[model samples]
Target: MYYEDPILKLEDFSLNIGNTKILKNLDLDIYPGEIILLYGPRNSGKSSLLRSFVHLNEELYNNVEGVGGIYFLGKSVFDLDRKYLRSQITYSDPTFVENLNFLTLKEILNLSLGLKLKDISKEYFSILEKLGISKIFSDLDNLKEYNSLKNWSIGEKISLITFISLARRPKVFIFDSILDHLDDFLLEDVKDILYRIKEDRTLIISTRNFSLFSDIAERVVFLDDGKISFAGKTESFIINYPK
Candidate 1:
């Protein structure tokens, strides 16, 4: 489902940190609902580029050169309200953690929707059931609200973090190697959610594991040493890789 109009565009984008040139003259045009895979070895600037979009590193953000423009739904990312714009674009990673220990998954999700509890009981349970988290987290009735984030297991912590991002209904989701720890069943479930979301949103993921999503992604962009070496259909990546 390629958008005739691109939702995100970066032209001649470049970034530098502490006198090191990270990204050099990068250009990318992506449409909504299209799956873009960034395949590269370690330290190839894949994660750095993703972070630039979300404005995570202030050093990179301040020292960035060129346009480095990002358009979300035809509006400049810098033009949108910080909070509202952030909700439209979520940057996720399996190891990505800020804080989620004090609250349960339910509380975090509610917070994403303005922290309102009204008219949420039904929708909340329905999502939990679909994500296969109802059992472990238990039903909402048995759960207690959290006041802080601390002592969350790896799986529980990641799942809840992802749930918060999804609840925002972002139009574009950028993930950095999120499938690192997912098992087969859980991977498929996450894929199902992405596919459902792809019906209306664009998903960009960076991964070194190609086998995990062979038939799921539409296109793969190979990056090496901060440069785009190849861009083509997902099925053609291996065949195109130098032997």
Candidate 2:
């Protein structure tokens, strides 16, 4: 992925749902292989902005109206099929990944990779090793953890999203509510893994606290009251934002 042009671009984008406007004329450009951390307090429209990329807010709101456009790889995302758009621009929230609790490890991978368990077993197992979770999986075998997800750690569940993202290889990964559950140690490890996966993929992370991932994110964007309050390099943001 060369760095001449942005992989994703938003132009004067605005969103309206019934009686209220969620995003107001926001413009942004996301380059290839860039790690972007979007920060804002709750109800600041950070989630809505991310959702607009895949046109997800439309489904959630019946009176949705979008002004302006979002282009992905120079193509209008509006023109693409919903399913294909979602595949290319993967969106995951806290509740989204936690649903893996109902499915086994292999089952989750099967859905993401579109492969049969028998064929994908050995391959995905090696990926698990890279994540340093092979021991957990091996232990789970004894407990038949494959059949139940209740015993799974929250960080482990979140990793399944990362695992699937790695296997499927999407162009963009919009992760919302990722800073809440994971511990500092796991966050550090996940930061390394995220950098690996991001060699060819762009990341858009929604967080309330940017300091937690300040070291990992290359760029930072802040939204306030449905508008962009700040957009700049990570170092610049860190220096300027209130602690």
Candidate 3:
């Protein structure tokens, strides 16, 4: 059997926030084409671990004291540029979507890709169609006239952000508590979209709603009080950590 190199590695990683130990000695190996479901209760350091990757060059990491480090593709995240690292490892938080209601869907996607809307290729349209949001794009002009996204439900906003993030086709997609806000129908759609796209990228979803994504997750990592309690195949995880 042949094993590919891990796309991301957290070696003895630890995090401290205001004298409280958030993540303690976390060592994880994430490979390409893997959908990892991070399961934990609130304040278990799921969001903190995910945010650390996004703010590799920010004060977030600088302020926190830790000996271990995160490595992307065998390179230390600390050595990479913030923008460059984010482009490869995109992070999305559903709560931030509503704040961006002023921007149209096209504008959001364009800004994510760093290109004008006109320059967007057929691939973008294909992704929208796959995610069942092509109609949203088709009616962009009419929708813009009314500032329609403002009226969208929380689920819709979450899905829109997920779609926009997917449009960028990042090497690693980090989703923080995105599934919790989604309804059953929308959740299934998003799961299907993740399955379709997981072949070419790594997906790290920090969600409390773990059972909903059990079928789609190749591996499950259970975090308890900032420590990884279990990390294994989905079936094994379910068997070991029975509800």
Candidate 4:
């Protein structure tokens, strides 16, 4: 399905970190329910650009200076409350999963909704089954005993993080350099989950593994030295920037 309305817009967006320029004159529009792939080598500003959308927190904007503006659902991102913006536009990275070690899978799942374990709906269990993590749920007691994401495999960590993100049901989801960490099987599962959930929300992912998502993403935004070097359909990007 095609969405005509723009869900996010960047107007002459530029970012500078100390003496270095990260992004330059970026003007882009993101449509709702569209899957966008942001790809480039390291330091191309893919992560920085993704972080800009939820820059209400000082941690993201501390060392950076943005000249232009970023608008989400027609409002400037800077004007939105930090917590509100974070709830609306969720950002997930590998490190995000590491922090979940303190909480059990049930607690982590209910974290976003502020629901008690007993209060969690049956739908949550249904989602866990659909994601093929019913085994993990069944072993919830044992898994909780680990008490640290450090004990889990990379695939398990990513899967759990993806599940938590989906449970949030945010309008926009941002993933940073996460696809490269998964094995082929886990990658396929993650992609399947993304496909099912993306029908209602926008997905912006940054990864060096461009070919993995080439067929799934509607648009591809290639960054070079902090500026968008190419922005168009997935096929066009592959053709023009041939790996």
Candidate 5:
């Protein structure tokens, strides 16, 4: 008999921000091509743990301390280059846009790839078509937006952020659903996109809504007060989900 190794592994992992303890000695193994629905209440360290995977928390927070090992493909996360690791294990948070030149529809969409819109516009729209938001623009000229995000709908921003993250072509995708304002249709589109790609990549979606993306989550890991209260198959998760 043979067994496969987990793509990502957390061994007795813990995190601290300033004087606050965020994650408490977490241990889990994430296999490749797995769709993991990571959920918890607000400030339960979902974002902190996700950021830790790419080591984003250390750069943004001055008083951050993390212990234990976070490994990707048997390599210590600390041993890898931050930029390269980030590109490979992308963490997409809708509200936290890094180095934003201008939060235009075009620029936001092109945030990850950094290629001219003309070159990838055809490929871009095809991806958007799957998410049902492709009808907003017919050509590259329609990509400009001067008002940051004030003029655009919340749904549009969410969709574009989701798409931008996917364009990175990462091995592991960690998405933070910041703007929970998207309608049902958009959520379905996002779910479809995730399901379509899960065969080749690993996905971890952090959401407050239990019902959101439940259909695609093969496994559910629940975090409570920075501790994993439940980690099991989605079917058993329903029976064993912490109250």
Candidate 6:
């Protein structure tokens, strides 16, 4: 397959928030069809880096310095239309929790497609059914009515939210600590989805959970205290930073 320019690129990017330097001259590029793992302990500036890429922190946006780039399919994310850029660079954090209240699986899927209020794909639900998750919403009414009034397991909630993410299939997908809360079985399913998406989109996952990335990620970058401590092949990362 002919390759395109970097789907997302960051070079010499640095951020200073409230007198604290969050990122120090970080450089990285993510090509299409690659899955990268960003692993580091809590408060290591992983979230800060994400904010910079997606333009989430308005206050910090002006303070960010460096000749870095954030792109979606060869177009600079900053240069592209904001709403259009958001459609391509989908960032899913723990805060996607609001999606949990979506009730039925179909409703959740519909909600995502409705985000841009774009055209609903006819085959979107078909993908869900193929992934063995369709049964979760076999009964749409009950699923939508499912409430926090009724306690659901973390595993179930994660599974539903993840399926919706896969359904969207953004060009640059970002996940922050998403799989840490999932069980092994569900984690495997999520991995399968990531692998399937590899042929078309780039996956950027940030998590402290290293084992999950050992087999899925081609490159591993370690972040420590707002700096890159290490970057290399996944196997080498495990051999050197064995938990």
lDDT of each: 0.70, 0.80, 0.80, 0.79, 0.79, 0.70
Specify the poorest-scoring 10-residue window by lDDT in model 6: 115-124
Cα lDDT of candidate 6 equals 0.70
Candidate 6, residue 195: how far the Cα is off, in Å = 0.7
lDDT of 1 by residue, 48-100 (tens): 88876766656335655434666666777667776676677898775455555
Residue pairs clashing, model 1: 101-149, 101-150, 102-148, 102-149, 102-150
How many pairs in model 4 have backbone atoms within 3 A of each other, for residues 3 or more apart or on separate chains, i.e. clashes? 0
Candidate 6, clashing residue pairs? 104-143, 104-144
For model 2, residues 1-243, the per-residue Cα lDDT tens digits are 344688899899998989899899989999988999999999999988898889888887799888998899899888988889888888888876568778876666667787654464776777766655666556546436554666777777776676676667789988887645677776777678777778788998899877787888998999999999999898998789885
- Model 1: runs farther than 4 Å from truth? 1-3, 59-68, 102-107, 116-119, 140-142, 145-151
Question: Which residue runs does candidate 5 get wrong by more than 4 Å?
Answer: 97-101, 109-111, 144-150
Per-prediction TM-score, please? 0.83, 0.90, 0.89, 0.90, 0.89, 0.81
lDDT (tens digit, per residue) of candidate 4 on 1-243: 444768899999998877678889999999888899999998898888888888832484557788887999999988889789889998987677667677665566556676554554678767666555656555458556544556776677777677667788899999887767888876777788788788779999899888888878999999988889998998887778888
Model 2 is weakest, by summed lDDT over 10 consecutive residues, at 139-148
| Per-residue lDDT over 1-243 for candidate 6, one digit per residue giving the tens place of the 0 to 100 score | 326677777777777765677788887767888888999999999988876667776543565543466555666667777667667777767766654654544455455665321333446555555445554445545455553412455666665566566766677778888677877776776788788778788888898878877789988989998889887788888889877
Question: What would the TM-score be for candidate 5 when compared with the true structure?
Answer: 0.89
Which ten residues in a row are the worst by lDDT in model 5?
139-148
- TM-score of candidate 1 against the unseen true structure: 0.83
The better candidate by lDDT, 2 or 4, is 2
Kindly provide the TM-score of model 4 when superposed on the true structure, using C-alpha atoms.
Answer: 0.90
Q: Superposing all C-alpha atoms, what RMSD in Å does each candidate have to the true structure?
A: 3.1, 2.4, 2.4, 2.3, 2.6, 3.9
